[model samples]
Target: MHPTLAYKWQCVFIQVGKFANEVFLLLPPYLPILAGSLSLELQVLNLAAAIVLIAGKAFWLKSGRITPTDFLATLDAYIGGGTANQVRVAILEAFKDGIGGIGTDEWKEAFTQLVLDNQMQTAEPLEDREHP
Candidate 1:
């Protein structure tokens, strides 16, 4: 992704993380009263809160923008083989040119080809039969 767009997304993620943290903090004080009055189990509420907090934290970390190492790793994964180094250099250059990064065309094309190939592979075999 473009650095500017990545930066923007990072800021947005940070804001979301802050909001989630505030919500998580507010949940604890109400837990006792909610559990007692609503006849709900304390364990269930605690578990749900824990899951939300963990997911929120993970999102925050993942959306904090990609580093150079991350970019290189991702490029390698997407364009594997002997051309990986060349692909990485090209991708970095594209990003530096403010080109908004690589498009999703390659991924979409790969997915489409995979589907077509699978369909062709699984097609029924033809058989010759005499008709009366």
Candidate 2:
């Protein structure tokens, strides 16, 4: 994998780790807890479990057991098809073009651009028959 690609994958996984930690921290022990009714014992147990699980997962992630190349290989396999390279190119170009990282709208436009650029569609746009 190229250095930039590897860096991007590492960044992606780091965000994943952050998200896991956030979710674990946010959830309460039980349904009643949301209503401000606390079971101290249950809360303690749930908090401990969450801490242990998050710690173990974080430890594994920081252990350096998995390299960026390995991750890229897995991702490439998951993406599949000859268009994997094309897709990557499209995404990189979109990023370069200043599309923000988050938001479905921007991503949708980027994908539409990719499709149009590739000439992937042959069909004409459908007309509204009643209006016609």
Candidate 3:
């Protein structure tokens, strides 16, 4: 090969080596940060999926189902804490007392009665309610 051509080739090789070395040197610091970012992203995805699942379950439970468990889930989600929770606890306690002896048909009857009782209470006017 010509001396000039050899020197040019040598210069190209040297530049390629320097570029490769720079890339390798930069990787050690960036790799951990990249890995950490990926890990955080996965964790965020997992949390989002869990939240979606919970919301979907609540929505499904509230979608006009007549099952007792579905009704209770809706009640809990809607009413939350305080007096509402007290009412829920009271209803559960009362139901549990006779639940062991009751069949499915009785459970439905009790639920219907409870709904009717609530409707009657809510349907009364304030003046009439004051007397009751």
Candidate 4:
């Protein structure tokens, strides 16, 4: 992938993460009262929230803004080799968890650590690569 395009997508992913966190935070206050007054269980409300979030992510996935190949390539840039594959798997799992559960700092840290620990796997020597 082109560096500029990849950078743009990286920013989009960051913004999506922020938006997901905001939605997660905003729902809690209203969920209980809304569900309780409707004579529904809290779990039902949570499920509904999950459905909405997951549907949004599914829409994004289906919209073709990011092709699977480009997504994998972008991930490979952050991390490399087999560990990148693992991170890819983790991303799929997160998708299953819903939008609010995806793209957290821990996921980014995992990629960063993989880059740090596996620098030797890349073409350049550790000394030649940019350090954080």
For TM-score, the strongest prediction is: 4
If both were scored by lDDT, which would come out higher, candidate 1 or candidate 2? 2
TM-score of 1: 0.28
Candidate 3 clashing pairs? none
User: Stretches of candidate 3 above 4 Å error?
Assistant: 32-132
User: TM-scores, in order shown?
Assistant: 0.28, 0.24, 0.24, 0.30
lDDT of each: 0.37, 0.41, 0.39, 0.41
TM-score, candidate 4, is: 0.30
Candidate 4, residues 1-132: lDDT per residue as tens digits? 999999999999997787556545544543443233232332453334333333333344446453323332322333323433443344344333433432578655543443344322333212222212
- Model 4 off-target regions past 4 Å? 33-132
For candidate 4, the clash count comes to: 0
User: Model 2: which residue pairs collide?
Assistant: none
RMSD of each: 24.2, 23.3, 27.3, 17.6
Stretches > 4 Å off in candidate 1: 36-42, 45-132
Off by over 4 Å in 2: 31-132
Better of 2 and 4 by TM-score: 4
For candidate 1, lDDT tens digit of each residue in 1-103? 9999999999999986876565555445434422332223323432333333333333333476433333223222322222223322333333333332224
